[model samples]
Target: MDMTLLSRLSDFEWRIEAHGKMRVPAILYASEELIRDMDNKVYEQIVNVATLPGIQKAAYAMPDAHWGYGFPIGGVAAFDPQEGGVVSAGGVGFDISCGVRTLLTALKVADVTTVQQPLADALYRHIPAGVGSTGRLNLDDQQLDEMLLNGAQWALKLGYGREADLDRTEERGCMAGARPEAVSEFAKKRQHREMGTLGSGNHYLEVQHVVQIYDEASARAFGLAPDDIVVSIHCGSRGLGHQIGTDFLREMVLQAPQYGIELPDRELACAPIESPLGETYLGAMRAAINCALANRQIITHLVRQAFAEVIPEADLSVLYDVSHNTCKVEEHMVDGHLKRVFIHRKGATRAFGPGHPAIPEALRAIGQPVLIGGTMGTASYILVGTDESERRSFSSSCHGAGRQMSRHQATKRWRGRQLIDELAGRGIIIRSPSSRGVAEEAPGAYKDVTSVVEAAEKAGLSRRVARLEPLICIKG
Candidate 1:
C-alpha cells in the first residue's frame, strides 16, 4: 500500500491495479485523510475481492472503508454467474442484513418530553435489550420455522405490527428466497430466544427529533417534519446470522478448491455459484434475514405499545428498513450488457436511485430512503438515492460514520457514568441495561458523520435529506 501503487481517479477516488491473481482493479472512493486513515489490510482485502470468480468490473470500497474479515467492511462486489461466479460468506459478515430502520411519529418533541421518563421506562420494561436478552414471546420449533420463512409478514399475522408498515421496507419486509429448513439446528436454538431482542454492541432503540431539513421537498415527501420525534432501531438477525457465517466459512474453505476456486486470501474462501454448498448457504442466510426483519417488526410493536401507555398520541409509522450486509442476485448493467449478478454488500447500504424497479411504487419518484445511523451520542441522517449513484457505485453507500477507534480503546478512554452525565447536560437522555455498553459506543470514537455524509453526496452515492438528533437513546 505504501508503494506508489494507487492512481488518483479524482479528489474523491483512487484506483489500485490488480496485478497478481486479480481479474480486475480495485476502486475506492475516499478523501485523502479518510484513505490514509484506512488500514492497509483493506487494500489487500479489496484485491482479494477483485480475484473473485466471475467478478464484474472491480471490487469497490465506500468512503468509510476499513479492514474486515474478507472484503473490506465497506465493500461492494458483483459476480456474474453466467461467467462462473462464486459467493463468499465473508462478504456477508456475521450479521446478515444488519441495518437501520426509522419510523416517523405524529407527535413532536414537545409532546415526548411531557412523559419522557415514563415513556423510557415503559420501553425499557417491554423491549428486550442487552446481551442474551430474550423476548417475552416464546416460539416452538414449528413457530420459529414459520417466522423464518415469512419474516416480518409472519410477525404481522401474529399481531406484532400493522400491514402498512411493509410498504416502505426493503423486499416488502421479507427476503423472498428464505428456506427455514436449510438453517442449522444450532443456529435455530441460539436465535429462538433472541427474536424481538436488541443485542449489545452498537445496537439500540432510540427516539430522535428531526433537527435539520436539507431537502425541503424530499423531506415532505418522506413525511418527515422538523422537530418531529421518531424511533430508530439498529440491530440485525443476531445469533442466527453469526451461526450461519460460522457454519459456511468452514464448509466453503474445505470445498473451495474442489470447485476449482483459488483463494487470494483464506478469509475470502468461497463456493461456486452453481455448487450445492453455495445454494445451501444462501437459503440459510435469507432465513436469517427474515429473523432480522421479523425481529425489528416485533420491536416496533413493543415500542408503539410502550408509547401508548404514556403519550398515547405518539403515532409511529414506518419510514424505511434497509440492511447493510448481504449477497443478493440483482440485475445490473455490466459492460453495456444487462446481466443477473450476485452483488455482495458488506457494511454498505444499497441506494436504489429513482425510477429503479426494485423501489416501492410509493417512493420510486423520490428514490429509496437511505438511513445512516450515527454514533449513539451523535446525529443520524436520512438521504435519498440519486440516479448517478447506480452509475458511480453498484448502488452502494456508506452505512455510518466508520469507527475511528476500537471498542476497547473507546471504553478505556470514556467511563460510563461520566459519559451519561455529559450527554444529559446537552439535553440528551441516555439509558441502557449496561453503562459499559454506553462507553464502548462513545460518539467521539467515530469519524465526523457530517463529513461522511458530505463524502457520500460528493461521490453521488446518496444525497442528504434530513438530520436527526437523538433525544432519548436506549442502548443494549
Candidate 2:
C-alpha cells in the first residue's frame, strides 16, 4: 500500500474521499510513518465503514488503527437514528468493553524493588489468567442472569469491591439499560465460570512506576505522582462478550436486507436501529458490556488483595477505569443542535473534554484521563482529553501502541524465554504461564506508542499527563 496515497488534511490527519457507495468520508489520525506501516486492509475497511447507514459527520480512525474483523480496531463512527442509523456487531468488536483501569498506590518504585519477585508471584497467584482460565465464582442459570442484569453492582454485592470504586469507573461500573434476556443461553454458559479470570490473548495485569508527569495539576487531580507505583488491569467481557458479538453478527447479516441496509463487506453487516434485530443486538451487547464491568470489578478486588499482602501499608485507590470498546447512545452537538447518536468505539477510548457533565466531578477540571496501555514490556501513558478531541473525533482517542505485526509473525521470530530475559535485563519483571504469550507480545511487534501519543497530542486529541514503565506483568 502506498501510504502516500492518503491525502493529508492536516499534519496529523488524513482523509479518504467518499467514493463509490460511501455515504461519508473516512478520517485517519496518525503520523506519516505510522500510516506507511498500516495495512492496506485497514484503508479498505475504513472505506467500508464510510458506507454505514446514517453515519454522522465522518468515520474516524485513531492513530492505533489496524485491520480487524470488519471495522478497523481503532475505529469510531456516530449514526443518527432519525436518518436510518444502523448498528454493526463489527463496530462493537469481539470483546465488548475490553478496557483498562489503573490504580495509584502509596508504595514507591523503591518499595517494590525490595520484594519484586515475591510481589509478582503473589499477584500471579491471586489473579487467575491463561487460556480458558476460570475463577472462584461458579454461577448457575439464575445467578448468571442476575450478574448479567446488574453488572458490577452485583459483583460488589457479592463482596468483590466497594461502592466508592464505582465512582472512579466509566458509567459508574454498570451499563444502564442492560437486559439479560437479550443474552443467549450460549452466552450465559460461556460466562458461568469466567467471571474473574483474565483470559488469554493480549490481556494483562502490570505493576508500573510513574516515570514522568507532564501536567502537574492534572496528575494531582488524578492522584498520581512521579515514581509512584501503580497497578494496571486490562481485560474484557471474556467468552461471554465474544459469544454475544458472534451471535448478533450472524443475526445482523441475515436481517440487514430486511431493513434496506446494504453492506460493502459482510463483516460490516448491520440492521437499522428501529428494527427488532438492532434492538436485540444492542440490548445483548450492553449486557455483555456489563459483564465486562463486573469482570474488571472482581479483578480489582484481587489486585487489592495482592497489594494488601505485599505492601500492607500502601493505599491503592483507582485513578480511573475506562473501556476501549463498545457502542453507546450519547448526545453530542452536531450542526449546532444536541442530537442523539449511537457512537461506535472499538479499540478506542472515550476522552471527553473538560466541563463535559459525563466526566467525574473531580476530573471535570482536567478532563477525562485517557489510559493508553503499551506493549507488555514497554511504557504506557496517561492523557487528558482535549476540546479538539471532543469536537473533531466524537470524544475518541488512541487505544494503545497498536500492533505492528500479526501475532503469528511475532511468535515466529521471537521466543518466550528470550523475551523474558531481555526484559529482565532492562529491569522489567515478567511472569506468564505461556512462553508463546511472550513471543506474541514482543515489544518489537508494536508501533512506537510514544510516536502515536505525540501525533494525538499535536492533533489535539488528548494531551499527555504521565508515562509509566512496567516493573512486573502477569499475562493471560
Candidate 3:
C-alpha cells in the first residue's frame, strides 16, 4: 500500500518490479484509498506468489485484496505446466470452490415485502446452516463417489435442480478430471453429512431486489431488472474441501524440499504441476470442486422448496453460479502465444469476456456473470466480465468487499443483538443460529463494496450490470 514500494502503471494499476528470486513482477488493481486501507500482508503474499515457479505474467491482487494464507485473498496468478508450474494449496485456500450463485424470481420487491419475515423464516428452517449443520440428504460411500464424479449433474439426474441450471454454472456444474480415488477416505467421511449445508463464516442465503441498473444490455442478458427479486446463496464444499486443503498443504510443505522447491514461506508450499503429488492434489481438488457444485445444487432445491411453500407463483430460476478459490486449467495468451496454464484465483472470481466458449450460450453475448456479495446490511452488485480483463489479470476480478478487520476486531466493535435490531429497523430481517456469527460479519468489518466494484470496473476487470439490496439474510 505504500506508494514508495510501487511504480504506478495507471490510476488503477500498480507494479512491484521483479527482484530477488521473483519470477515476475507483482501487479495490483485498486483505488488509492482502497490500496492504502489494504493490509500490508497482501503485498507480502503477492510478492511471495511472484517468486513461485512457473507463474505466468505477474501475480495480481484485486481491489478487495487482503491478508491471506499465502496468495493474498484476492490474488490471481496463472502457471504454465510445461514450465514446471506449481500449484499451491495456499493459493486456492481451504474453502475449495467457494462461490456465489444468484437466482432470479418473477416476484417483485413489493411481493417479497408482503411476506418477508415468513419467507426468511422458511429459508432458515429449510436450509441447514451454522457450524456443523447437516442436511436431510446424507450420502453413503457409493453416492459420495457419484457426487464427486458428476457434480451438479448428479444432482440433476436425481431431480434436485433443473437441467437448465447447469448451463449457467461454471464448468457446467462439474470440473473435469475429478478422481474420487484421489480424495482421502477421511475427507469423504467429513463430507458425508455436510452436503447441502451452509457452513459457518461468511456464508449466507440472502433475498435481494435489484436497486439499480448500470448496463441495460448486460442486465437483460442476465435476466435482471430494477426491483426484480433474487436470491443469492454463498457457500462451498464444507468439510470435504477443508480436509483436502489441510492434507495437501501439509504434504506439500513436508515434501517441497524433496522436489527441490525452496520455501520462501512454508505456507506457500506447492508441488510441480507434473509431479505425482501435484497430479494427486489436482484430482482431489477437482473432486472438491464437484462437491461444492453438488452442494449448491442441492441447496438450490431446498431454496425452491422454501419458495414453493411461501409463494408458489414466484418463478425462481438460475442466474449464474461462479466459484472463487480455485486453480483451474485454462488457455490464455501470454506473450502473444496461446498457452494452456493453471490459473489460481484465491478469493477472486473468474470474469471471462463476451463470446468466450466456456460461458453459457444464453448469456455469452453479454459475458460471464460476476456475482459480488456484500455484508448483511449493505448492497451487493452483479457485474459482467469484460474482454479487457482477459488480457489484464487472466480474466479475474474481486470476489467481495474484503475484510477491513479481523473477526475478533469486529466483535469488539459491535454486539450481535444490537446489530440485528439495527438492521431490522432498516427493514432488513436476519436469521442465524449464532448471533456471534452476525457480529463477526458486521457491515463495518468490511471495505465499502461500492468503492471496490468501482475500482474493478475502472481497472477493466469487469463491468457493472446491476445492484442488489438485501431484504432478508439467513446467515451461518
Candidate 4:
C-alpha cells in the first residue's frame, strides 16, 4: 500500500494507470486512511485482474478491500463475452451467493429486551449452526435437484416461507439458467443435509434494533422507524458452493493453457466465456446460487418458528435479501454505449439504483436496500443504492467491515468466553456452539465499520439509510 504506487483521483478514489500486461486501469475506492491500511496484496491482485481478456472499464475495489484469492475480496470487474471475456472462480470466492437478509418484525426494542435470552436460546436451538451442522430437512437426490433448480420457491412450496418473501429477494427467489445436472454428485451430497443450516466462519443470525436513521425518505420506504426490531441472517451456499468453486477452479487452471489463457496468477485461472468449461461452471455456479437462496428461505422459516416460541405476537417479514458473491450478466454503459457484460463481485454487494427494472416494484423508486453486516458486537447499517454508484463502480458497494486480522490472530488476542461475557454486559446476547468461533469473529478483528461505510458513501457507492445495533446474536 505505497501511496506513490497510485495516483490520487480524489479523497476517496485512487488509480493505477494501465502498465505492463494490464488491459485496463485499476481503481480503488477508499479514503486515504483505508488505502494506507490495505494490504499491498490487494494492489497486486486488482492489477492482475486488469490483465484478464475482454475486461471492460477498469478493475475496481471497494472501500473494504482486503487480500484474498486471485481478486481482492472487495473486487469488482466486468467482462464482455463477445470480446473473449473470461470467468474466474477465484473472483467469485468459495462462498458463492454468500449474502445477508434482514427481516422486519412488528415488535420494538422494548419488547425484545424482556425476553432476549429466551429468544436467543430458541433461535440457537431451532437454527442449526457451526461447522458440519445439518438441518431438519434431509433432501434426497431428487429433492436436492428440485431445490437447486427452484431456489426459495421450492422452500415455499414445502411450507417453509410465504409467497411475499420472494418479492423482496434477489432474482425473485430462484436464479434462472441453473443446470443442476452440472453440479457434481459429491457437491449434491454435501448439500443434502445442509439446507437451513448456518455454516461456520463469519455467519450469524442477529436480532437488532434501529438506533439511527440517516435518510428519512429512504428509511420510510424501507419500512423502518426508530427502535424497530429486525432479524438479520448472514450465511451462504455452505458446502455446495465451496465444492462448486473447488471443482471449477481446478478445471479452469488445468485448461487455461489449452484456451491460450496466460494467467498472471494461477488463482486467477479462467476460461473463455464461450468455452464449454465456462458454460458448465456458470451452470453449476447458478445452481449454487439457488441453493443459497433456498437455504436462507428455510432459515427464515426456522427463525419465524423461534420467534413464535418466544413471542407469538412478533410478525417477521423480509426487508431485503442480497448476495455479494458470484458473477452475473448485467447491462452497463461503457464508453457511451449500453452493453452486456458479466460482472464479478467477490466480497462486494450489488447496489442497483432506483428505477432499475430488477428492483422490487414497491421499492424501485427508492432503490435497492444494501445491507452492510458488522461483527456481532458492532452495529450494522442499511444503505440504499445510488444512481451515482452505477456509474462509479458498476453498482457495487462494500460488503462488510473487511477483516483486518486473521481468525488465528484474533483467537490469540482474546479468549472467546471472556469476549462473550463482555459483549453480554453491553446488552448484546451471544449464543454459539463454539467459543472459539466467537473469538475468531471478535469486533477488534475487523476495520471500523463506521469508517468503511462513510468512505463508501463519500465514494458515491451508496447512501446510508439506518443504523442497527445488535440485541441478540446467534453465531455459527
- Extract clashing residue pairs from model 1: none
Give the Å error, residue 115, model 4. 0.2
Candidate 1 lDDT at 264 equals: 74
* Model 2: ten consecutive residues of lowest lDDT: 1-10
lDDT assessment of candidate 2? 0.90
What do the candidate models score in CA lDDT, each in turn?
Answer: 0.88, 0.90, 0.94, 0.95
Question: Which portions of model 1 show Cα errors greater than 4 Å?
Answer: 1-3
Q: What digit string (tens of lDDT, one per residue) describes model 4 on residues 1-476?
A: 99899999999999999999999999999999999999999999999999999999999999999999999999999999999999899999899999999999988988999999999999999999998778998899999999999999999999999999999999999999999999999899899899999999899999999999999999999999999999999999999999999999999999999999999999999988899999999899999999999999999999999999999999999999999997999999999999999999999999999999989999999999999999998899999999999899999999999999999899999999999999999999999999999999999999999999999999999999999999999999
Model 1: how far is 28 from its true place, Å? Answer: 1.0
lDDT of 3 by residue, 1-476 (tens): 67788898999999999998999999999988898888788888899999999999999999999999988999999999999999999899999999999999888988988899999999999999998788887889999999999999998988999999999899989889999999999999999888899998999999999999999989988888899999999999899999999999999999999999998889999999999999999999999999999999999999999999999998878999999899999999999999999999999999999999999998888889999999999999999999999999999999999999899999999999999999999999999999899999999999999999999999999999999999999999
Task: Please state the error at residue 269 of candidate 4 in Å.
Answer: 1.0
State the lDDT of candidate 1 residue by residue for 97-148, as single tens digits. Answer: 8999898889888898777777878888888889878888778899999999
After aligning candidate 4 to the native by TM-score, how far in Å is the CA of 399 from where it should be?
0.3
- Runs with alpha carbons beyond 4 Å of true place in candidate 2: none
Candidate 3's displacement at residue 247, Å, is: 0.3
Among the numbered candidates, top lDDT falls to 4
Better of 2 and 4 by lDDT: 4
- Cα lDDT tens digits, model 2, 293-334, are 899899999989988898898887788999999899998888
Which ten-residue region of model 1 has the weakest summed lDDT?
1-10
* Every model: Cα RMSD to truth: 1.2, 1.0, 0.7, 0.6
